[model samples]
Target: MFSRFLVFLLFSCRSLAFEDTYVIGAGDTIQISVYGEKELSIDSLNINSSGKFEYPYLGELSALNKTPEQLKAEITQGLLGDYIISPKVRVSVVEFRNVYVNGEVKKPGGYEYQPGLTVDKAIALAGGFTDRASRSKVYIAQNGSDDNKNKVKLSEKVLPGDIIVIEQSFF
Candidate 1:
């Protein structure tokens, strides 16, 4: 019964953290299309590990934490003056970041990130916890230089590029 409640809470946090428009992050590939502009349409434009993309006209643009629509608006704004008038731009994610799960997990490796990913969902992707895994001692470690690691509930929302560490139980 308690485990079931945890699952419910996990999904709730997942939905809240990841809604319709997912925030773009580093290592994500985005496809951009500008209506009627052949030169502006780009495919498989990968955001570098530093969260930047070298786009046409706009040069290098930051792609960290901005929604696709927000990126589209920025691109359109950049193309206005000398290039296009009222550029109808669209940005779509070609691929998302990969999340890693290590220690005490069955698989213990990196997995592709989906829209609504939670700690439990990531653990499940990693083939669930091992026999010695501690259910209440899991943590989410930010893989970036920022390093915001902390103990987390199974219900905690896991972001792309996050590292879910399932510590081992003593007993």
Candidate 2:
């Protein structure tokens, strides 16, 4: 039983890491640094709408659906020998994708996405909805999805670049 519990714990941690870590998306800003390569380092870079971005020597690489660790490995592999004899690359999301909150919220605007942020937490960040807000019919429109927006429960995980709206109750 103890051994089984330990295995479960290990797997759970790994699962949480992937679920919580920010996936690179359009509009997210990344900071990249290559050890020993000053010219290749950048403080901030935007992932364009196409999920691709330009890098020195690398030209353009798609960053969508990838994590920072994955991007770092990609950059390091691409720069090896051609750009640097031994390249150690690091990539970090300086600014994650925004979650837009509109309608019935005190502050209806975009807020920075945080790891493990849920729909309820986002609504809290927007000042906990208005007096006439309907908690049950909270709408979420995912990025890249069209006409597929649907109502979600409070505990639903809000991904980056999602638009949330709190419908006003007809009380």
lDDT by candidate, in order shown: 0.84, 0.86
Candidate 1's displacement at residue 18, Å, is 4.7
Error of 1 at 36 (Å): 1.8
Give TM-scores for every candidate, taking all chains together and pairing residue i with residue i: 0.80, 0.81
The TM-score of candidate 1 is 0.80
- Among the numbered candidates, top lDDT falls to 2
**83-110: candidate 1 lDDT, tens digit per residue:** 9867898888878889999999989898
The global Cα lDDT (0 to 1) of model 2 is 0.86
lDDT of 2 at 76: 90
